[model samples]
Target: MNAHQSLSRRRMLGLAALGAAALAGQSTITAAPRAAAAPAAGVSDGTFVPAVVVGTGYGAAVSALRLGEAGVSTLMLEMGRLWNQPGPDGDVFCGMLQPDKRSSWFKTRTEAPLGSFLWLDVANRDIEPYAGVLDRVNFDQMSVYVGRGVGGGSLVNGGMAVTPRRSYFEEVLPQVDADEMYSTYFPRANSGLRVKNIDRGWFEQTEWYTYARVGREQAAKAGVGTTFVPNVYDWDYMRREADGTVPRSALTAEVIYGNNHGKVSLDKSYLAAALGTGNVVIETLHQVKTIRQRSDGTYLLTVEQKDDGGKLLATKEISCRHLFLGAGSLGSTELLLRARETGTLANLNSEIGGGWGPNGNVMTARANHVWNPTGARQSSIPALGIDDWDNPDHPVFAEIAPMPAGLETWVSLYLAITKNPERGTFVYDAAKDRADLRWTREQNAPAVAAAKSLFDRINKANTTMYRYDLFGKRLKAFADDFCYHPLGGCVLGRATDNYGRVTGYKNLYVTDGSLIPGSIGVNPFVTITALAERNVERIIREDVKDSHRD
Candidate 1:
C-alpha cells in the first residue's frame, strides 16, 4: 500500500485500540489519536462524505466536535491553507512588526484595517503572492477584516472570548432558548474553548498591562464600570513571559498577524478535540464555490483548489447527506445569496442575504497626557474593558485595546462595541458573480455617534483629547468604515428558522455568527459558539439521529 493508505490504516487501527481500551476502563492508550479521515491537502477528485462543514471558525469547530462526539463523520472545508507548519524563516507565522506576503491574501499590498500610521504609509508594505492568515474583504463603504486560515478569526484575534449580557442576547435572538443557552450551552462552550481571565495580581503590576490600567483609571474617573474580559490566551504563560521565564508572544506585539506562543486559539481547543474524536476530517486550501441540492435531498458542493500563488489548480464536486455553513457573516451570506440569485436554489427565502451588521464596531484613540505614560511594553492580549452598556441613551462596551509599538506613544486605543440598530443587506452582483454588502457610509454615523458619546465622557473627565494621529488623515476619533467583529447577514427567524434551519431546505443549516440579527453588544465568537452548540444538539437529536444509528 501507498504511504497515505498505510497511514490511514494505522490511524484506524489505533482508534480501534483506543476504543477497546476505553471500554475496558483503561487509563490511556499508547498511540496518539488522529482525525477519522486524515486532513487532506486539497480537494481530491470524486470526494464524498456523510457531512460537510464549510469554514473552521468557532461555529464550524463546535459543530464538527459535537457531531463527531455523536459518532457522525464530517469533513471540514477551509479556504486558506494550514498555518501550523514552519516557513523558511523557521517561524510558523509572520509577525505584525514586519508583515510580509504572508500577512494578506493575493493582494500585492497588505490592507490592514488600520491602514495608516500617522496618516502615512509606514504601516503597509508590498509583497509577493502567498496564502496569508488575515483577509480584509473590502466593500464600497466598509471593509470587513476576517481570519483566513484553518482557525478562522481565532488565528488573528486578540483571543477575547466574551459573552454578551443575557438581556442583550435575548434581544438579538429572542426566539432562541435562552434558558438552555445560559444554563447549558454557554457554559459548555466556555469550558470547551478554554476561556480564562488574566491573573489580577500580575495584571496590576505587569508593565505589559499599563495601557489597560491607564484606560481603567480614566474610565473610573468617568464613573464607568470596568470589567476584566475573559480570553483564550493562556495567562500562566503570559505571567512566565513577564518574568522572563518563558518565550514572549503578547509582549512581543503579536495580535493581528498571528501569535507565536501563549495564545490558545481554536486550533488548540475545539478543532483539536474534534480531531481527537477520530470522526472528523478537515480539508484545507479548498474553497466551496457553490452549493445545490440533489433530487434525493443530498447537497452537492463545487469547490476550487488553489495554490499559494492564487492559481486555481482544479475544481471538484463533493456530495454530502448534510451540509453546515460556518463561513462567517460575509462568506456564508455570499454563498447562499449567489445560489439564490443564480437559480441553483431558487426556493431559498429572500432573507438569505438580509439583516447584516458590523456589530457596531468603531475604533478610536485617546491622547494621554505626557505625564501619563501608557507604557512601552503593552500586552497584545487585552483584559480590561469599559462597560457602559447599561446606559440607556448611548450603550457602548469599549475594550481598552493595546498599541504595542514597543515604544511609549502616550495614546490609549479603544474598540467600542455599540448598539447600532442599522442593518445591511448583501445583494448579488451578476457582473462580478459575488454579493455586495449594501451598508452605506451614512449608516455608520449612529455607531460613531454612540461610541463618541461614551469615549467623550471619559476623555473629558480625565482631561484627555481624541487622538488625531492614529487614524487616516488627522482624523480626530472613531474609524467607522471597518470592522473586526462582522456579525449577521443570514438572520435567524428570517433567512432561517429560529434553530438555524434554512427555510425551504432539509439537512442544511447555518451555524455561524451570521445567525445573529444585528447587534450583540460584545465580542461575538462566544455567542456564536454557544448558539451553534445549542442548535447542533437539536439537529443531531431531531434531524440526523436515525441516520447515525449504526
Candidate 2:
C-alpha cells in the first residue's frame, strides 16, 4: 500500500481502539446534538445555572478553561470538529507546518474561502454590503484568512507569539492597566500556548533558514534591526532536528493552513486542559445562528447542526444563564450583526457594528541574492523586530516576523506589521449566513501611504545588501490585501463596554478578536488570548458576584 493508505489504516485502528476505551465505561454514544435540530417549545424550567460558553475557538477555549477552574460549569459549543488525527493530507510536517490540502479534517462549509497559510481567497468571493462604500474597490485585491475548528484560528495560524508594543497597547486599551496585563495576562498566555524561541542549533541545516537570515541581514543593513521573537511550539522537536533525527523536510514551511508539529494550537493546550476538567463539555459541529435573551436574563440560543457533507441535520435551542461569544471576529460579528440587523435583537445599540480595522496588516516579500546560510534554519524563529513603529515622525506601529526559508525561489519573506489606520466593515448576511467584509483605501489614505513608503525604503535598502529585486516594482502592490491577522469589528468601546459587556445586554459578553477596539499593530492571537483571560477573570470575580446579589 502507499504511505498515505498505510498511515490512514494505522490511524483508523488507533482511533477505533480509543473509541472502544472511551465507550467501555459509558452507554452507546449518540451522534452529538445538531444545532438545527428542533428543541422543546417551552422555556427550560430547570434552575438558571451558571454560564455556558457557546464556542471553542481561542477566546472560548480560554474562557471555558478559566471558568471551569473557577468552579463554574460551562458547555462549549463548536461548529467544527476537533482536529485529533493527523490531517488527512500527508503534508503534516514539523517546524513551520503548513496546511495539508489533502486533509479530510479541513472543512470549507462557510462562504469565506481559505488558501494556504490560512490567507483569504479573495479572488473567489465578493465584498459584503455593510462593508461600506469600499465594496466597489475590488475586494479581490484583499486577502484575509480565518480558521474554523475546535481550536479555531489557533489551529491554522503561524505560531508567532509576539507581545504587542507596550506603548501601542496602552494607547488602544488604555483602560487596561498595562503593568497588570504584561505581568498577568501575557505570561499566562505564553505558558498556556507553550511559547518559546526557535532553538538556533536545529534551524542551521534547513534551506528555509536561508530566507530568514538573508532577510534579517538585509533589514539590519537598512537600519531596521530585525530580531527573532518567541513562538508557540515544542522545543524538543527542534532539538531533534539538531540531532538529525528529524529531517529539514520535516520542518516544511506549511504554517497558516495547519501545522502537524512545531507550534501548539489550542487543541493541545487550553482545550485539552478544559476537556480534562470533567466540568467542561464541548459539542462540535454545532453552529450558533441567533441568540435571544429571556425576561429572566437567561439566553436562548438557536443553533444549526450540520452533517459531514455540510447538509443541515437539525436545529435546536439551548438556554444558558450566561452566554459567552468567543467565535472569532468574523463568526461572532456575523452572529451579532445578523441578530441586530434582522431585528432578532433590536435592542442592541448603534455601536454594535462600529470600530472595525484590519490591524493595518500587510504581507510583503523581499528577495536576497547571496543566501546567508549561517543559522538560517534555526532563525526561522522571529527573534528580531524593528522599532520603526513608535516614531512620531512615521507614526506607524510595525514589526517584521520571519518567514520559513527555502519556500520561495529567492532569499526570504517577512510579514510587515504597519499601523495602517484602514478600517473595514462587517455586516451580516442572513441569506448567506456569513459576514460581508469590505476594506477600502479612500478611508485609509495615511495607512496606505505609510505602507508604501516603508516598503519603498526596505526595497531600496535590499539593493545595497544583495543583488535580488524587491516587491516587483509595485509601489503599493500589497496594501489592498490582508494577512490572516484580522482584528476589531465588534470593538471593545463600541460594541461592548470596556469590560466586554455588550451595551443594553446583561449576562451576555463577548471575548475574542472582536473585543479589540482597533488594530493592535501585531499578530492579534496573543493579544486576543490575553484579553480573554483578563475578561473572563473579571466576569468570575465581578459579574458573577453582581448576579448573586440580584
Candidate 3:
C-alpha cells in the first residue's frame, strides 16, 4: 500500500478499536498500580515539614524529583489531570498528541486557565467572560502553546533535546558556571529524560526522511549545512515501527498537540521515577490561586479544586516552609507578577517581569522536491543542525530541522535565534482572576527580520532541491507571528536572583523556562532542564543543608 493508504487504514482501525473499548467500558491497556508514599528521610519528624510544589510542568517535576531524592517531603500540586488518564470526551488527553481535537479534557484541568495553541479557537472556560479573556491578547500574531496536564509542556513539546549554543549560554547566563554546569547537570538531565538520537533506520524508512531531506537540501542551497540530532523518545516503539508491527500511523507527526507513540514527557519520565521514590505526593486538579507569606516566613497558599465541569467546588488552604514555582515562563511570571502588583509580595525589585522574549521560535515550512521520498518522516525528527548562523557578524542563530508532513511532500522547521526584545509585562485581571499577557510587535522586529534573512539565504543557495517562498512572503508581508517556543515574562534576573531565588520572598524559588532571560536560539528544553538541575542541586547543597547544619 502507498504511504497515505496505509496511514488511513491504520487510523481507521485505531479509532474503531478506541470506540469499542469505550463502549465496553474497558481499556485495551491496563494501568500499573499507583506507587505508595514513603516516609521522609533526612529531617526530624517534627522539624521536617512537607513542602508543596505548585504546577506539575517541567520545573515542578524536576523540583519534585530533586527534593524527593534529598529525602525532603513534598506535595506536588498539578492543576491538570494525568496525561495517562482518559478525558471526559472518552479520549486520551496527551497535551500535544491528543488524537481528538475537540476533546473537552481541558475543561476539568486546573491548569486549563493557562491557554494553549490546540485550543486557540476554543474559549477558555476557566476564564469568566471568556470573550474578553480570549480577545485581550494577540493570538493571531503569536501562537502560544502551554500544557495543562501532569507533565505540562513536556507533554506537548516536540521532544527534540538540544543544548544551547555555547556562546549564547556564556553570554546570557554569566552567573552560571558553564563548564561545571554542563558536565554535572546536562548529562543528568538527558539521562533522566532518556534523550538519544533517532534510529538511522527509522529515518530511512519513515516519511519524515523526505521532509528532512528537503530541509537539508534547502539549507545547503543557502550555503547552510543541516545535520541530524537526537530526540527524547522510546527506542523500542521506534523499532516496532521499523518492523511494521506498529503501523506508521502510530508514529504520525501529530506532535505539538500530543504524541501517542513517541516522546518521553515528564509524566512518563521524571515524575514517574519521583513517584517511584515514594517521597513525592502529587495532587491533581488543585489550582493555586494565591500565595501569601505568613508572619513566621512560611508560605500560605490558597488553592481551588475544580471538577470536570471547570467549576470551582472547594477552596483549600495549605502551608509549606518552601515553595517552588515551576509554572513555565508565562505561568510563573503571571503568578509572581500578580502577587507583586497586588501587594502580596510588593517588596520585589524592579526586575520582576522585566525581561521577556519568545526564544525567537518562528515556525515556517520549506518545500522540497516531490520525488525525494523522505521516508517515515513522522517517527523521527531532523537529527542534525547547522551552526553557521552562530556568527556574531550574521547576528542570528538558526537550526534547520525536518518537520513531519501530512499532505506536503517534504518540509523542515527553522528555529532562529534573534535578538531579545524588551521584557513584557503580565498584568493580572482582577475581574477575570487571571493574567493578561501583552507584548509589542516592535520588540521582536529585529529578530523577525534576521530570521527571514537567514531563510532567504538558504532558499537562494538551494535552487535545485529546496525553495523558501513561504518565508520570503512572510518577511515581505511581516505576517509570520507564531512561535513554537514562548519564553520569559518573569525572567531570571528580575523575578528571581542570579540563583533563581525570588528577591523579596524567602524560601520561594522560580525555575524552568522562566529563568531563561531571553531566547536561546535553539530548542530550550535541554537548557531549561540543565538549569533546573543546577539550581536544584545548589538549593540542596547550600540552602537546605545550611538550614540543617546550623
TM-score (C-alpha, index-matched) for candidate 3: 0.79
Candidate order (TM-score)? 1, 3, 2
Runs with alpha carbons beyond 4 Å of true place in candidate 3: 1-49, 86-143, 201-206, 247-250, 369-377, 380-382, 395-405, 409-413, 464-479, 546-550
List the candidate 2 regions with Cα displacement exceeding 4 Å.
1-49, 87-141, 200-208, 246-250, 370-383, 395-408, 430-433, 443-445, 464-476, 545-550
Model 3, 1-550: lDDT tens digits are 8733543343344334324434554312111212233323211212223467778777777888778667666777777554453446543542323233322343232122113322242322332211000111234235465766667777655577887767778887887888986788888788777788866776655544555555666666676765566677766676676577874423555454455565677766777666544456665667778777879888778777665446776787777777898877777777787787787877877676666677765544454455654444344334556655554544555555444434444445555556655445566677876666567667667776776676667756654322334333222222235555667766676667777888887788987787887677678888888888888888777766534222
Among these predictions, the greatest TM-score belongs to 1
Model 2 residue 284 CA deviation (Å) reads 1.1
lDDT (10s digit) by residue, model 2, range 1-550: 8733543343344334324323442211111212222122211323233666766777898888776555555667777654454323443321333222222233322121212232323212222211010001114345456665667777666567888889889988888889989999998888777688866665454543554555556656667655566777676775665467864332554444456555567766776666544345565667788877777778888877665346677787777777888987776777788878877677887766566776766554444554443333433444445556755645443444444434344534445566765577776666876677766655555665665566567778766222122333233244435556667777887788877888788878899998886588777888898989888888888777535223
Model 1 over residues 410-453: C-alpha lDDT tens digits? Answer: 98999999999999989999999998988998999888999989
Which regions in candidate 1 have their CA more than 4 angstroms from the true location? 1-43, 548-550
Of the candidates shown, which would achieve the greatest lDDT relative to the real structure?
1
Q: Quickly count the clashes in candidate 1.
A: 0
Query: What lDDT is reached at residue 178 by model 3?
Result: 89
TM-score of each: 0.92, 0.78, 0.79
lDDT for every model? 0.84, 0.60, 0.60
